[model samples]
Target: MNIKYILLPLVACSAVALAADPPVEEYVYGMRLDIDKVVAISEPDELYAPCRVVSAQMTYEDSAGQLRTLEYLRLSSVCSDIEGSL
Candidate 1:
């Protein structure tokens, strides 16, 4: 009914929508990953870079039904092409 009351909910929703997501975790050598069901994976920016290391994010559910996210590094897909060419 009032302007203040209407604006309050809108502000709250905006805050939640604009909140920054946490950075993905970097993978370590021999680190154990417990990915249950794959939710989504963030795509690499440079898919065409040859032999270049690219960053990726994986969102998944763990064995305990907890949602988790992990970031890891991997060679670009083009690397395989180069390797195969040689």
Candidate 2:
């Protein structure tokens, strides 16, 4: 049997796999409010330059116990790049 013929299918399969999206990982995080104050978040340096804070809003609970809502600020960073040693 020729080695090239045997390897051809394996190479093709790997190529297709490589072209697919990366596997997603899910994680949860906890946060605390240290103090009530104006807040600012900085983008990680690896992200593309000129990152923008897209939107911001405030929500609150009314004295009557009514619910409130807030719009989240959207931030983008160049997360497609894998950084650091695996």
Best by lDDT: 1
For candidate 1, the TM-score is 0.63
Candidate 2, residues 50-76, lDDT tens digits: the string is 545444333344455443333454554
Per-model clash counts, in order, read 0, 0
TM-score of 2: 0.26
- lDDT for each candidate structure: 0.78, 0.45
Clashing residue pairs, candidate 1?
none
Model 1: CA > 4 A from native: 1-3, 14-23, 81-86
Give lDDT tens digits, candidate 1, residues 7-45.
999999988876645446778889999988998887566
Local error of candidate 1 at residue 10 (angstroms): 3.1
